[model samples]
Target: MQMSQLVLKTLREAPSEAKARSHQYLLRAGYIRRLSSGIYSYLPLGLRVLAKVSNIVREELDSCGSQEILLPALHPVEIWERSGRIKKMADVLMKVEAKSGDFVLGPTHEEAVIEAVYQDLSSYSDLPATVYQIQTKFRDEPRSRYGLMRTREFIMADAYSFDSDQEGMRSSYSKVYDAYNKIFAKMEIPFEPVEADSGAIGGDVNHEFMSPAEIGEDYYAKCSSCGYRANIEAATRGSKDADAQGVGSELPELLYHYTPEAPGVEKAVEAISDLGVPTKAHEMLKCLVAIDGDQRLVMLLVPGDREARVPSGMRLLEDPEFERYPYLHKGFIGPMNAKENSIYVVADLSVKERSHFATGGNKAGYHVTGAVLGRDFQVDEYRSLVVVRDGDPCPRCGSALTLIRSVEIGHTFQLGLYYSSILENARFTGPDGQQYPYYMGCYGIGVTRLIAVIAEHFLDDRGLIWPVSVSPYQVVVVPLGAARSKEIEEVAETIYSGLLKDNVEALIDDRKLSPGVSLADCDLIGVPYQVVVGSKSLKEGQVEIKVRRDGTTTKMPIEEVPTRIRELLGRSL
Candidate 1:
């Protein structure tokens, strides 16, 4: 490709909004242009990388006997409602008001694809089939930063599998699981599979393929001992039941002290301890009021030192929600017998064991010490919950688990009948000739996000360092002689043509630019190899070859440059 003819625009400085390394290089290299917040336009270079990524995904899925299919993006709300996700995903779903009816830009294809398949497919013979599509998906990301890493609209490869039984679904899932391992390996990025919560998608078991990166948005725990890995949302501590420091029939008076300055648990703990009570931060109970999906308030009690983690389908009470619960003291809320006030309580398992823990007195500027578990507050059920932190115990081996930051590139869910059973007319006949809901599995790979993740993982200070499998161009021809130099121009063209003849993607920098300028962009563009035809090297009857990944160069005879380039690229001329 000629640089002059191509719509390539390299920037001297990355846009101010492009903060991440991948985002900075991509913008500066003229690979992508910002369309709006969380949205972007892929230029020619970006499109080439996207194409290579899509091709890799298609080839891998095709290898697993997965058939390709495209589902409609403009979907009726009825399908989402039928799947029970209309409300659950309302926050991120992009809804549109059409002349015909309300529709949602499809974020996923669970309902649409299954609705189509169950209409036509039946019987055990058609039980196990995986259908996939590489297409654009939409999401209303609340905070879409980090360029392609978090986008409102992006490309994705989503696969849905149907099986007669759970066993068939497992088989299908395993194939894709192994295929994902192969996919990331082929892309040359370091990744780990972590157990994750299947939020909104409705699955009991799911694994997110996470690429370890410095600026990753997700945090996962990997056990150093037994190799237990899980996302923080689903990860658990290895410890046993919290000790209920046995309670007697008689209870002591709960000590409530006036603490006007102590608004938070930490401050309250210090104030209470100064008032002749021995206390520690961990000995204090922090009470929080959160509104559930039903718009009812639920009380949570974590240790004073721990931060609360809110999972999907639930959010912390906002100002409006707080206004509804006027009786509950703001900032000084506690678990009281608030059932009359429509506030239910659920405490962490650790809180159930602690005797004489400290908490808010449900009154402004007052905190209570010697607060008993059953005597002061109670929960309908004690859930095994603990705040996730670095070096937390591993659920598998009881060893310390370290939290690793990662980018979620792919996810696979064992979505057992969640969609097929919910959507209308979605059923299949089994070998017993009895109608049963379809056993389903869902898998997805973020095509655009993978590009960003790849750039983040493979690049260096100079610019993007694309892996050979996903580089926009395998080799770039840098003619060091000015465009007026016929000899340099001829040598560069010959090399570019030879590469094309060998079925290699090559970019020819034939523009009338200085060698230094062209070479700099060549490096920033991240072509895997650069064939430099310089007058200095040409005088020695040699052409210079520069390896992009590592700044290693070799001088080879001009006659052997094409074959040498092929050998260096691990391809044929």
Candidate 2:
């Protein structure tokens, strides 16, 4: 491609609102332009990068025997209703009213894909079919940020597999898992697949491929010793004995203390500290009031220093909800009186290790001390409901865990019969003349999001450093003073043509711009290699080759430039 004719305008300053480095560089480098919040238009360069990523995904999935098929982005609302996801995914579903009827812009194609393949594989002999598609998806994201990472509309490579039973489904899942490993390996990025919650997708088991990044919004826990890793939502910690230390042989009776100024755990601790009693945040029993979908109040008890993982279909009690239950104090909630107030109480597993705690007195601005678990409060059940933290013991090997911020690049779900059972005509006839719902699996890769993740993952102080596999152009040829120096221009054009003939993706800077401007733009765009066709270098019968990754320069004879470039890219000369 010739830079002089390319429709791109490099920016000197990124937009003020572009906080993430990838977002800033993609805009300043002219890769993408924002159309609206959470929507973008990929320019030529950006589109090329996306195409390269999509191709890698396609090649990997195809090699695993997954046939490619495109499903409709516009789905009938009735299908979603029948699948019972219309209410479950209502928050992100984009509804549309048309002349025919109501429709939904698909955030995912689980329902659509099931409907598409229901008839083709009716018999057991035709079972275990996998189909994939690279297409656009839409979601009504409440807050989209960091460029393509979280967009309302973007391209995705989604695949669905159908099998006769759980065993066949797991086999297909394993194949796709192997394919995803190869796909990310080809992209040249560091990633880990961790056990994750299926969320609204509704699967019993799933894994999320994560790439560590400072700007990532998701977090995962990794065990340092045993190499156990899991997404935060699904991560678990080692269990402790119910009769662990901190339990006293003779516990003191629960006593209420007047703390008129205490509104939170911190303030209550302060008020108690003023009374000459030393206490730590972890010594306090924190009770979280929440309401389920049925409007039943439930009390979640955990250590003050820990946070409760709110289960699905439940949310923390809000102000209006507090009004509904006049007996429940907003900030001063306790589990000691839960049974009396008709509130179900669930306690974290860690709470069993500690017997006595400083807890709320169930009244505004009041707290209680010496409250023993079995003496004063009774828990209906114990659960691993606390968010896993750094230094937490690994559930698998009892090793200390480390938390990392990462972006989810891909996800694979062993959906079983979740979608197939709900969709119409999704059963197959077995050898015994009985019909059963097909066990299913779904996999997805964010095609456009990868462009940003790769940019974010591999970069320096100057700009984005895209991997060679996904770079818009592998080599950029810059001829210093090309318009003024005919010799330099001829040499650059010759080198560019030679590289192209050798199947190397090359770009020539033919614009009449200053050397500094062109070279800076080259670095900003992050092409893997730069062939400098300068007069001084040509005088030595050699040209300068600059490696973008390490900023190393090498001089080779002009005649060997194309071969050298091919060799550097691991291609046949």
Candidate 3:
């Protein structure tokens, strides 16, 4: 591609609203232009990059026995309702009304694809098929910022596999996992596969492909020594051996104290200490209120030495069912008052084994000390309810788990029968002649987000250093000051044509620009190899060859330019 003909508008400064490096560089480099807060129009350069990303994804998906197919972006609401996601996804799912009735922009195509497959493909013979699509997806992000990272509309390459049973689902899931690892390696983006919660998209198990970034929304933990990594919500902590201070024989009787104006835990603890009650003799029963349809109590009993917060896996606030449980009082909630089926009490694992501690008095400015679990209050269930902190032991290895923020580029789930059973996407017949819903496995890659993530991982202060496998062009030929000089233009054109003949994708910069402007634009666009033809170098019968990643430049004879560029790109590509 020639720069003169290309719609290339290089910017000296980035937009003020561009918060992320990828966003700024992409906008300035003329790859993408913003249409709205979260919507964008991919220019020629950006479309080329996106095409390369999709091609890589297609190769991997094809290797995993996935047949590519495009599904409708506009889907009927009845399909989503049948899958039980319409109500659950009311917020993020983009709904629109047609001339007849209501519909939704396809966020993910599980419901639409499942219904289609059920209508067309049935029987065990058609079982265990994987269908995928590289298409645009729309989501109504409440606050869309940071470019493609949290876009209201972006491209995604989502694939779903249907299997006869759980065993087949596992087989397909492993294949997809292996393929994803290869794809990321090819993209040259360092990532960790961490266990993740299937939020909104209900499933048995899911794993997120995370790349370390400061601007990431998800908080994942990784053990420094052992290399064990997981999303904080799904990650587990190693068991700590509690102090063997046997339960004291003279355990104090539970008694209520009138505390005035002390509502929070710290103040209540301070009031207890002022009353001369032993801190160890009292368990701190923190009543966490969550609404499910009515006010429900989630009780946490932490040791006096340790503090407690809401656990990650607990569906307290984010759950759609919480809207119904609106009566749960916030801040001033407790476990003592029996509301006759008005509250559901869940206890943390740490609280179940604790001895006596201070608890809410179920009233304003009051507390009860020496309250024991299973004695004063029996919990509905015990859960791994403590938020795993840094320096916490790793569950896999005994090493400490350090929390790290990362962006989720891809995710794979062993969906089991979650979607299949709900949608009744079943197959018929075996030797036993029994029918059952197909087992499912879902795999998704944020095709556009992966591009941003790669840019995040591999860019320098100048601009993006795109990996060869996904770079828009394998090599770029920049003829510095070629607009005025015929010799430099002839040399650049010769090299560019030779590269094209050699099957090397090359961009020829024939624009009327200075050396500095051309070089800066070359670096900003992030092509791996650059062949620079300037008057000074062309006079010496040589061209300057620059490697974008390390700023390594070498002088090559004009005749050798095409061969050297090809050799470098061949090895990397």
Ranking by lDDT: 2, 1, 3
Candidate 2 residue lDDT tens string, 272-391: 888877778899989988888698888888898887787665778877767877778766777787888889888888988887899888888788888888778888888777899998
Q: Candidate 2, residue 492: CA error in Å?
A: 1.8
| Candidate 1 root-mean-square deviation in Å | 3.4
Clashing pairs in 2: none
User: Which residue window of length 10 is worst by lDDT in model 3?
Assistant: 325-334
RMSD of each: 3.4, 3.0, 3.6
lDDT (Cα atoms) of all candidates against the true structure: 0.84, 0.89, 0.79
- For model 2, what is the C-alpha lDDT against the true structure? 0.89
TM-score of each model, paired residue for residue: 0.90, 0.91, 0.90
Could you tell me the C-alpha RMSD of candidate 3 in Å? 3.6
Off by over 4 Å in 2: 239-249, 257-280, 289-299, 311-333, 337-345, 360-367, 571-573
- What is the Å distance of residue 226 in model 3 from its true position? 3.8
Q: Give the Å error, residue 92, model 3.
A: 0.6
